[model samples]
Target: MANSRVFLAGLCLVLSAAILVYPSRAVTAAPNSAQPKLVDKDAQESIDKGLKYLANTQRPDGQWYPSGSYGTYPTVMTSLAGLALMAGGSTPESGPYAKNVRRAMHYILRVAEAEKDGLIAGA
Candidate 1:
């Protein structure tokens, strides 16, 4: 119970940070609407917060909840994080999360090289 509370608190903090950081990326218009309408800023803020939290809470090795103590955690984390970064449009060259994406990609690649079957190729 205590652990759950801690986790929830962390999640909330991350979400708040995202809303404060990226206000513009909150929403997209629904298709086929007869009238043009803007999205809710507060709701968009909530979504951005969630994304930020997920990104922030990722383990250093790249995985969210990695298992296997013998370096497997790092491998798994890297693969998972790399995929997540990619989904967020992070790349080696540019984008808000370029650095993180590059790092995760590198980590996953290194793990793959070290042990071919150790990590999943795709997150």
Candidate 2:
């Protein structure tokens, strides 16, 4: 019985490691949220352009805060930008600004995950 427990523990460890090293489906999977459903072409274009502007304004190190900025304004700006894109029904897989949105989503996810201890930020 003790040996069985050890073997199971080892197997579990290996499986957990594999899961961590493997790419997360969250990064590639379609969002399940009905709130982010796709929109018309023109609307999508607008969302894409807006996201483009936000991404273009980001710092080279992938941040919305300017150097020597005060308060959480940077965080707030980034958060708002992400929310706007999400509200416009954008995703990394299928959206008007899929690439830029994905990049922005990734940045916000990192911050949210680090601060909130969860991946429930952009989605």
Candidate 3:
């Protein structure tokens, strides 16, 4: 129960950060001017690399770190990682990290389906 609360808090923080750092307003801005100023080239590259690492590290079952330090919070990690990919402009339907997004979504859905309740479990 306590773990779930902590996970919820952390997930909320991540979601809030994502919204602020990657606002929808930036998407409509001129790519040649406003967009470039919001994030630098190197920072963007680093983000790309990190997303790629996350994608590569995903389990064949569509989860990440399912039995390690993050094992206790599979749903939280998956949600946060998926949000990060989305914040970087990738969706399950399109974009560079589409596969990752889709995989995470599928995993989450599977977990939800297996559970009697709507809430996802941490373990």
Best by lDDT: 3
lDDT of each: 0.53, 0.54, 0.71
> Compared with the true structure, what per-residue lDDT tens digits does model 2 show for residues 30-94?
76875565587898788678767776776643457645545445555655664565455554444
| Model 2 accuracy (lDDT, Cα) | 0.54
Candidate 2 to truth, TM:
0.40
Question: Any runs in candidate 1 off by more than 4 Å, and if so which?
Answer: 1-31, 34-43, 58-74, 116-123
Angstrom error at residue 12, model 3: 15
Alpha carbon lDDT of residue 99, candidate 2? Answer: 54
TM-score of each model, in listed order: 0.45, 0.40, 0.66
Write one digit per residue (lDDT tens) for candidate 1, span 30-118: 46768755557786677567557656766565446655565445555655555555455455555666666555555554444454344
Task: Write down the RMSD of all candidates, one decimal each.
Answer: 14.2, 12.5, 7.2
Tell me the lDDT of model 3 at 94: 71
Best model number under TM-score: 3
Model 3, runs deviating above 4 Å: 1-36, 66-71
Please tell me which model should have the higher TM-score, number 2 or number 3.
3
